[model samples]
Target: MMKKFSLLVAAFFIACSAYSQYDIVIVGGTPGGIMTAIAAAKQGKTSVLLERTSHIGGLPANGLGATDIATRGATTGLFSEFVNRVKQHYIQKYGAESKQVQDCSDGFHFEPSVGEMVLEQMLAEQKSKVTVLKMRQFDSESQNISMRNDRIEKIRILNRESNKIEEYTGKIFVDATYEGDLGAAANVPFRLGREGKDEFNEVGAGRVYKYWGGTEGEGSTFQTDNAVQSYNYRLCLTNNPAIRLEVKKPLKYNRDEYVSMIEDVWTGRHTGVQMLQVTEAMLEENRKHIAKGNVSKIPGDVWGIARITNMVKLPNDKTDANNQHMAFISTDLPEENWPWPTSSWAWRDTYAQRLKDYIQGLIWFAQNDKELPEHFRKAAKEWGFAKDEYTDNGNFPRQVYVREGRRFEGMYFFTANDATAVAPGKRPVIHTSSVTASHYALDSHAVRKREPGKVHLDGFLSYPSAVYTVPFGVMVPKVVDNLLIPVPVSGSHIGFSTLRMEPCWMALGQAAGVAASLAIDDQVKVKYINGEKLQKILLGQKATLIYYRDVNPADANFEMVQQLGLRGYLPDWEARLNDAIDQQTAMAWEKLSGKKLSYEAGKTTRSEVLKSIYTNTAPDNRNASSH
Candidate 1:
């Protein structure tokens, strides 16, 4: 009996020591997470992607088919590849000259299922090096993270379905969730909601509206530290009756909640029409079809035209519906999403159900309500949840659109100044060796007040800005050594509003994966990895580290010029002809391009300097690979 007891003890110890290990462990299978795992796998690193839900491609796969990108040139690396594949998917299904192919030329919009299929195919291509575990939730409270000094050695996960705890060990960990769950679990310093204007001297910081449906006279622009933007589910709707699932009245449907919105539209306080011209064209098409006595065949484009937030048209008569800026009819649920960042899974699910109920109730009210305009009612009735999309979740989106979440307080905090290029003469803080380039306006959904119809547009800034580089420091936490946060990055709320797009997140994820692989190779902290070496790797992988519309990659010294541009050595002096290149700038340019330039006032023309720089840095063997 004693010998048997000793053997049992030894077996238990052996089992405990055999926790599953990988080169990298990614928590939260958002687009960023999926891209991170894929990027790491491409580098021959064994990786594990643990997703909380059955789906993998978060918002893009769920319902956000309309890619909200500022410019196509701004995208690079895996994101560019993904968009290209999406375009090819349409081109192959439809002829190259079809409208589907033409529309997807600049913007790649597809059905939610297609997004999932593409992501699955991409992962399958790297299945040997990547392990994806769906329905695995990260237990922040009970799970243990084995920490050796500042680095995390292992992470504990609680399976949501099995109710079993499992441990995963990895050399580097990435928190790619929109919520920054892994970073929160690791006890890294992070910020929830907006910051005070004084904190980062941000022009767009603070709460703007104090009352809903009230004029600016009744609102204030005071900074509130706890005001977070709204959250919603990007509904995938289709007009085809064959695959359209009628919007059923949710169990907790409440008519009183939608009374204010209906009244706003009825009183003309809020226009029932959409803000974009696409909706108008669709409406005209519907009118023409009706005049021809073919109302039934009036096309699905006429449906969901009233909601301008994101009424993006997709292939196969499907649409991706998102929140509009309407007074109360928008999908954004104010004051309800505040607890989502730190809430327990049970609480989150409850909140998610409430949002679904609210949205469903709104749809039902718009379609069936006698008080609404007849045309609006008809349009609403034409659309329903796409039966083929998100079939596992009752044809609803599997993931709610989390616009913003816990932003890490990392090595560098990007601010609104960095977003809008207000300082340094229309130049945002440039991290020349950036992994991603973002050029979106600082856009935030309405943050309504306690009043049902009241909302503040404090976070909306629509001014166009120059493309800004997302620095590697934003991914590396200041205190945490091994973790990388690509989605809920280290940026101010206004800054995040610009970087929060799915494409940029995927780009950052790719960068994080490369940085992690390099860190593991060198056995150094993420911050300690050589920036130039990492940049070289990213550039080699076709990642865009600098933004120069005039400079083409096919140029002789394009690589060197880009490298110099990233380091802030190459300034657009022609655009700022009145301002001369400083001595420091000239020295750095010479050092990088190996060309000396005259710093004397009015001595060098911009074109001459550029030509000289390119000639000096051009490769000795022109036939050699640029990479």
Candidate 2:
């Protein structure tokens, strides 16, 4: 049966063979792959983008309404081009300047079909240079990888769907998938889950801590520590009331598992937590929790869905269909995501379907079930499914949330020191410094139960952090010699908290593609590539390579930001400069970015309000990931 299946797979690729050879072969139709293909094409390299799924743009097009771009400068290269296309698409669809905030830039948040259209447009722009293969699974056994000394000679992709296998030789290959499958097949050493302090001699390991949202990694409490942040699907909910999208039940669904998780959440067990620490206290506390494996949070909070809090608004409007947002309160299908990174396609699909069912079940329970009250029903009802969010699959997103995965042990290991703002002159000087700046503190999930006896879930944590530089070396591996990681699973188990943002991944993907192209053209290994040359290339492409240390906070741009929109956030430069960035403020960026301000001079905050509303000392917990 296995042999027959193999032959059938071979037959599939043979029948649907599209392109035979190319300069690059990128597996996984993830955003990272899409961005890499775009970058490679723009660099005049012939590339083949093969994805297991039919659509592209990954999560942003799937269900994540908000895309996380750390900084204005990080939005350059192919990533910038994609954003530009989104702007143009939005303008064409919604009239001129209809969605633009006072900041003069149009916001992201367009329909999912529009997101696909934008990617398709990008592919069209580089038509001759790139070929996209959908529903094609790569088979390493058939590829016959011939390596001389250290470089890869050729790789063949067997299209299981069409029964056609295509072989191509290339000087470089990028493992752009969320799961570093290609890298693993190529014998790369990667780390999954948390890398305790003992592994890297760092302080933020082996324990669970709470990091707040706001500033850059600041205001964190010792709520829980030493746990990886949970994962879930970003539901594209709308309160439009005009459209009626039914919440369907998932197959093989069991309410018991969720019921338990949510039960723990109601008791403030494991819901509210940051992917990264935001505050010094939260970091410390998270360390303790990691040691104990008893992370907890509030179940009833809306942020309980998926604990992501930092959300920066883009040039587009909050209402734009393609616009991306981040938050602490989200529908995180935690139990569903555990198997995806290592699962086979069949398993992954089954897991995703289960996750969809879980989310649908949660929504249905919230709306129809008697457990929720009048206020909860009204609030949830206000949020419905988007009419044009996910165009490929029931307008439901096709991408799964990949919070953390394989971290390649690269030439340069990005440690806690690299992510810390106080590292002084230890900043890594990379050939290409992407425009994004990550501020969220090192954070992880707090495994708890749901509230109201509905489902066990809890989420929220205000951690402390400062904007840190992302080294180019983090993306490239050390021993494997050629592969580059372009998505959430880039480098640093703990540091992935901040770098995992969609914009950051796309930024890295664009840079990795550019680097691969350079390596091919200049005949240099990824590690040996000239930093100055790479930096020049990146800067030329408008990626913020330098920290712009000389650009005063009082510059015209700063003043313009103040005068136009985001009045509340105008003081962020001063507030965050001396302190760490928190999660709440970061999440606020998703809905407000350049247009609306997230803070006021003096307003008793939400966390504080909640604390005052319900005060209790959390029992001490030790983290297992701690040193």
Candidate 3:
């Protein structure tokens, strides 16, 4: 049976390769992959974007409507363009003053269908250069990919629609898949699971237990393990009867999967499912409960289905439902996803279907199960899958939220420290070769299943992160000369939590497109491309590479100030163009240029001196890539 199956799989790529050679071939029609194609299109570079799913957009298209953004300033360029288009989509479809427009929250909040429509609109604009082939999964056996030396030449992907293997040759290949399947097939060295605490000295490294998303401290004895974070479906749900479908029990429903929730309800640990309506009294009560450190007892006033699941609001009375952050028993299925990174197509599909069934069963159990409390069941009964969303998939989302995947061992390895500050309350490490800036907490979901005496699942951590820059090196593989990975990027497990956010991934995708174009233009390895030139091109496209407090994308001196910031002159947030340089700024400047800067109380200001230096100095002399 095994031999016969192997022969059947081998028959796919035995035929001739389809399509002409492209300047860039990107796998995964994720938001990152989509932006990559669009960015390449802007450069008049023809590219092909291959998606495994029927739809193009990843999570955002599925059910991730509430955008995970720390600040609007961190997301720009193509991502900003995408958001503006989403807002416009609502404005045109409904009126500019419609309730849907107000619900969009400046294009940040939206429905899954709206998100997909906006993304498709963005892709449509690049129809000339970007050819999107949906339902195409790349074969990741390391045999289908043709590699000459360290560069990828072509990849053979199985077209699920026609059951044919189509070969795509490209000057530069990008692995934007959440799984990093193309990179793995091309033999890019990568890391799976958690790194040891001492390996990177990352604060959240290793396997251990912690509370309320506060990660373990550095230099701990916890050992590294192949325990990836949990995976789940971000279900788009609505209570509106106009477009609501019953949360029916899946065909293969199993009672054991959700039987544990009954105990949670009895102990008052599992809250009701309705979205919470908070008041000042509820807030104070919740605070005191947490301060007391007895999580088994949630405040009576705040208990509900909201405790176990997150329902971030959207337009049309819908929600982008997700696994609750602090909920011990949530939608996320941990430990079982260990095989997902390297699993075969058949195995993955089976597992995904099983997971889909499992969640569907859980919802059914919550709504109609005999063991669940009457009030809990009633709270859940009002909810159902949004009928208008994912109509082909029976209102269920298509993409399962694969938060972390195979992180490549690239030129730069991002650890938890990158998201942390140099000192307490200070900015994170400023990269001179920064391609983008993003802000998100180190939010890793549970890495293990329920364990005895643990408040939350092990490795379920989340804490604040400083707004930090992502260096170009994170996307450049050390050995893959022509390949770049923007999604399953070069990040450690803890560091990946922040980079995994869709908004940041879009920015990284933009950088990958620009870098791929540069590599082809200069006829150099992706690593050898000029960093300053890449930053300049991205700046021209309106990307915010370095984030500052006072100076934003709107500032007239934004580009110059950002360049100066890279040179270590403007260390603080504010540019303070006319204000005298502080001691910290003076010290940072001296450290960069080896010259003494005199404040003289008031005469010298930031803009006066910095702009003069910038105009006189040649671009190469800036030494922005010194880091």
Candidate 4:
């Protein structure tokens, strides 16, 4: 009888060992998931991060070393720290005065391998508190979620190699995947396509078709559709023969895809004139380079009929190439990515491979096609994949760039109106519980083709926008009590165009981690956490919750600047107004402190006015110290 009892006890313990609990379980190891794990671990939470592939850092570490940032000053918190670390890495490797160090002085760009190294180092710093499980994907098949009273109790994950299953229970969960797979598996309500203008009163929320170098177009500004933006892999290429892998024709290459492109070039539809028209100086510069016997290296004229010439310079003669719009060809394949977000993992892998094949074929066609211009062909041949990058993936990017994906329908729906500052009185609805600021333009790639050779560039709105705050509600789902969605966030298709930038996603992930830590510590639902206290903690973490153009520690009113900035009263305080104590400064002070001040001569200096503002408005109970 005692032997039988021992056998039963052993079985029970083995089952329990298979299921473990953590303070936070984050799925997906994109920048957002990495930041989430780092933040939660810093807060002393037992955090676990699950990545679907062997690699992490997503596009930034894949091939997109040229950071797409709108306003550089808006970067703060963990994202800013990551950039600074990359900057330091470059400075340490190359001398500070070197061109490579100067290029990364703005703390934005770096090599793919350098980015991967820095991200891995960050994980290493928190290895004691954070656990990273690679090649573990959330199982959507068995619907393996244990829920009780609408809260997710545990999630079952599948090991891709071994096909073994393990359960993880977390006090709070974060859906940081690019496809929103966890939120979808949890049965959260979500909208897949663009919403019409009337649905959210968004002026830039619909389908659009425009001809290249022409005004011919059709479609309402608010027309709704199920179409999504195109996705592509950001290729890291090199011109140096020492580490360059020449473009090879894929086994599945088809010449039919190049027929239209060749015809367009012959018909003058794909000439380089459209790019030259950007400025007369650029046209002159191109002519000068061509006159100097650099026929194959003329600026903006290297791609012939293909529009794959958007190459941003990286260190050591490398580049990060992306798509550009030409009359006939573009790097984006909108039609091929329709089912990627909803497909199974196996199907998604097949789709990714097909995209890789198509992009490779396009490159080979541009380089070796006989009908193309000889100069352009020679220039294309000069560039190839860098052998030093993505060594495990055969010198190719490990992941395809998913520009936009499943947006969570959360408590606060950030719409185009919110992003465009088009609320009542043409002012943005300010969120007092702001956590991070996003300043990128509402930029979306092509979504559909209106006709042959003409594509509808829907969801593209380039407007001067202020650095806007992302509210905490954007990450908290309306239905899920314990889940936080940092990427694939709660926003409309148009709003997500700006919020989907890499740095913004990292900021949101950091905020989600902090919120998750607070909720776990207080033993409360994420929605019930104190917003003010959460904001305080975020500020302590060096998060930029507000925008100011000229308010740093150097100012005498630095405390007042930060205090008012935290409440979202200062609009462009970062703008260096004239050195004089102007009336505009007084007006801003009045708006923030609710007390008007006279800007009379000799009445008060700028420093005195700021001191008074700080004395009157500073919170007495809260500690005023920087992190």
Clashes of each: 4, 171, 5, 5
Which predicted model would earn the best TM-score?
3
RMSD of each: 6.9, 15.5, 6.8, 5.0
Q: What is the lDDT of residue 617 in candidate 3?
A: 61
TM-score of each: 0.84, 0.69, 0.90, 0.87
Residues 525-617 of candidate 1: C-alpha lDDT, one tens digit per residue: 888777777777777777776666665444445565566566556554112323455556567767766666755645554445655665566
lDDT scores of the candidates, listed in order: 0.73, 0.53, 0.81, 0.74
Candidate 4 TM-score versus the reference: 0.87
Task: Write one digit per residue (lDDT tens) for candidate 2, span 204-299.
Answer: 443333322323223222232323445566556544556546565556556554344332222333322333323445445544543353433222
**Full-model lDDT, candidate 1:** 0.73
What C-alpha lDDT, on a 0 to 100 scale, does residue 558 get in candidate 1?
A: 52
lDDT of 4 by residue, 555-578 (tens): 455445555655544544453433
Task: Supply candidate 4's per-residue lDDT for 419.
Answer: 56
Question: Which is better, 2 or 3, measured by TM-score?
Answer: 3
Give the Å shift of residue 54 in candidate 1: 0.9
